[model samples]
Target: MNTLYPVMLEPQEPSGYCVQFVDIPGAITEGETLEECLFNAAEALTGVIESYIELGQEIPRPSENIKEAYYIAPDARVQSALLIRWARGDRSLADIARALETSWPSAQRLENPHHSPTLKQLERAASVLGKKLVLSLE
Candidate 1:
């Protein structure tokens, strides 16, 4: 389940770009430069995901409306989380739960895209998968 959402970048006034995710309405931001806009978009997307998870709301499934829209990759948090789950592969969820010192259902919840995972949890999962979760800003 790729969470890369389609983003519509609308130029505003003389020199700024306003970006909005098609599937997750209200997740939008503007920046004076393309680089800044992407950085802010990543922040906005992560906030939206965290809010939905906190409120116990389901994060809407991404639409196929990317026809003419540019895609924004999921934020670092999401990327790391998904990576941990994907790396789990043939490994059992129960095994993951045992590794995380949690229950099976809780482990499954970690794999849920709508649920935002804590950095510590992600690192633990990555460690269990024999992978290292690294983050760098550029």
Candidate 2:
């Protein structure tokens, strides 16, 4: 199934930006500029989807009842990544919320894959997760 989720971009100091999957926790991409960040985001999303499919897990479907939401064409590659993450037993929603200094509900929304999270929130989440946020020129 194809799912559309909002990506939130935030500007950083020195000249760079970051991207995050609004609905998926710990899914983030960064770039030196807005355009680059978006490009990278698309790639990351693809990878996540692919990973999920490979694991033979049920990929989450976006709510059909909602309108005005953009769906990222469902890609097996991106789904696979998400599946793997789910299997690995990574940070929980409450854990992430406390780490990011946000509330449980807000963090839950970030995991919805339908909500958009701000860039600043992404950066902070990355830090908490011990993931490196990178911005490339290419």
Q: How close is candidate 2 to the true structure, as a TM-score?
A: 0.43
Residues 7-124, candidate 2, lDDT per residue (tens digit)?
6677788778777765654457789976687678777766665555455455554445434332343343233234223532566878877877889887665444434556566556
Report lDDT (Cα) of residue 121, candidate 1: 82
Error of 2 at 35 (Å): 1.5
Show model 2 residue runs off by greater than 4 Å: 63-138
Tell me, by lDDT, which candidate is best: 1
| Candidate 1 residue 40 C-alpha distance from true site, Å | 1.3
Which prediction has the highest TM-score against the true structure? Answer: 1
Model 1 steric clash pairs: none
